[model samples]
Target: MNKIKLTITGCLGRMGQQLIKSAKNSKNFKLVSLTENRIVNKKIFGLKPQLNSISAFKNANVIIDFTIPKCTLEVLKIASKLKKKVVIGTTGFSKKEENLIKKYSKNIPILKAGNMSLGINLLMYLTEIASKSLGDNFLSKVFEIHHKHKKDHPSGTALMLGKGIATGKNKDFYNLMGKKYLNKKTFPYSKKINFNSIRKGEIVG
Candidate 1:
């Protein structure tokens, strides 16, 4: 039996760098390719792995993307064509991009996540509890603290907190990050939910 081959996109980002490092350390995974915005040094993963030349995924069985939505869509298309399993960790997808993922999921085993943090996902569950029991009369507020360098401002964990609360209340439209907050107000918003973002130095979520 051969080890499973893996490819990573946005291999230059912080998380991408971490995944590559982990994969290099894992015995069951063989890194087949790396994708980046521009052609850079080839010594990624400290092994000089081959670069992924085909957007259609010619070199690996699985593809992981931690890039922007536009690049995600392109990678999704390529993964669909190659019929490779894809794990997407990119956050802040537009409505259209979300739908596109669903559209292609029928053909590929695509794992999509907002924050992809186990602790934060657990926190989402707790936020559900708060949303369910807390009432408008209680005047509850939700908050998030993240490193200033976080790619997704407000963090996907914060979005999940608001989502958990909405599910608890059994109603939507209760977010502090405006629907178009990223494009406009540049933050989450809720009259009561109050989604907040913290940007600071060396703070890890």
Candidate 2:
């Protein structure tokens, strides 16, 4: 079997580090690039990705991005232009940014998920079923954990879980940004995504 050529954007992140370790242990993958603001030039498993720019990965078979919301669009544009398969693991995209991603997907194979780990995916599925079974009587909340430096208030995984709850109750996303400003009753929903974010000191990069 031939190896799948892979490049990782946001390569210094937790997810990126996980992928790097997995790829090193697997016989089926060959990592060709590692793009991040930090640690881009570091060698992995004795193989250095000869790259000075993201465009160096033009021929890469797959590009997995875990970059921040600020960088997601620019990276997606590059991937679309190269006609490469993309796996988007970034989160916190605005409505306009999401529509742009949809537009870009028409040109190539794209798979977008806030959480890429198989376990998290199953959790979302189960949450949907439980939400449906439990019905509108219960309100839903969102919570998550990440490295101490994570900037987003609610983790992407938390929001994905919230969406699963909405599916169970059959409701659209309730933008919980401002309830008191708009008067809470204007949008009717018993369930809301309550997010709790934590930032603390941690040594693992």
Candidate 3:
């Protein structure tokens, strides 16, 4: 049987590295390319990393991206032209950027998510149900904690929960968005959903 051609972007990052190990161990995928924003001097798993471009992704059947919003968009643009499928696991995108991704999806198949954990997705689904069941009298807020090294203010999972709240309310997530606070001891609940994120030593909850 032929293996699925796979290109992994942000090859040096934590998620990228994890995907590399997982993909290498799996029989379904053949890691054809690895990409980063800058040039990589060393070879990883026998393939040198390249910058995101049409040429870099031209030969792949699918591209899995675990990069920032900027880099993800760059990869999407090239992948759209190449007509390749993409799986996006990156986070921290504004409403406009999210819209841009939807636009690209019109041209090529794309699967995007803030978190891939089954438990988290189930939690998100539950949140949507609760939000929808609750009346307007109830207020909503989100809190999350991540590794100290994580840079995004509100983790992708937090945004996903907020989106759940919006989905329940039958309102736009951006329109319902409230202030985003990082490492704050306290935050207020408003007409819109608020998000508070705490970053410290790795906590998996």
Best by lDDT: 3
For all candidates, the clash counts are: 7, 0, 0
TM-scores of the candidates in the order shown: 0.81, 0.78, 0.97
lDDT of each: 0.73, 0.71, 0.92
Candidate 3 local lDDT, 110-139, one digit each (tens) = 999999999999999999999999956789
Kindly report which residue stretches of model 1 are placed more than 4 angstroms away from their true locations once superposed: 45-56, 135-140, 173-192
Evaluate model 1: give its TM-score.
Answer: 0.81
Model 3 residue runs over 4 Å out of place are: none
**Candidate 2, 46-117: lDDT as tens digits:** 545443255656757998777787667777777777888888888877667878899989998899988777
RMSD of each: 3.8, 5.2, 1.1
What ranges in model 2 sit over 4 Å off? 38-54, 174-191, 201-205
Superposed by TM-score, candidate 1 places the C-alpha of residue 75 at a distance from the truth, in angstroms, of 0.8
Candidate 1 structure quality by residue, lDDT tens digits, 166-198: 677776633323432232334544454665566
Candidate 2 vs candidate 3: the TM-score winner is 3
Alpha-carbon shift of residue 151 in model 1 (angstroms): 3.3
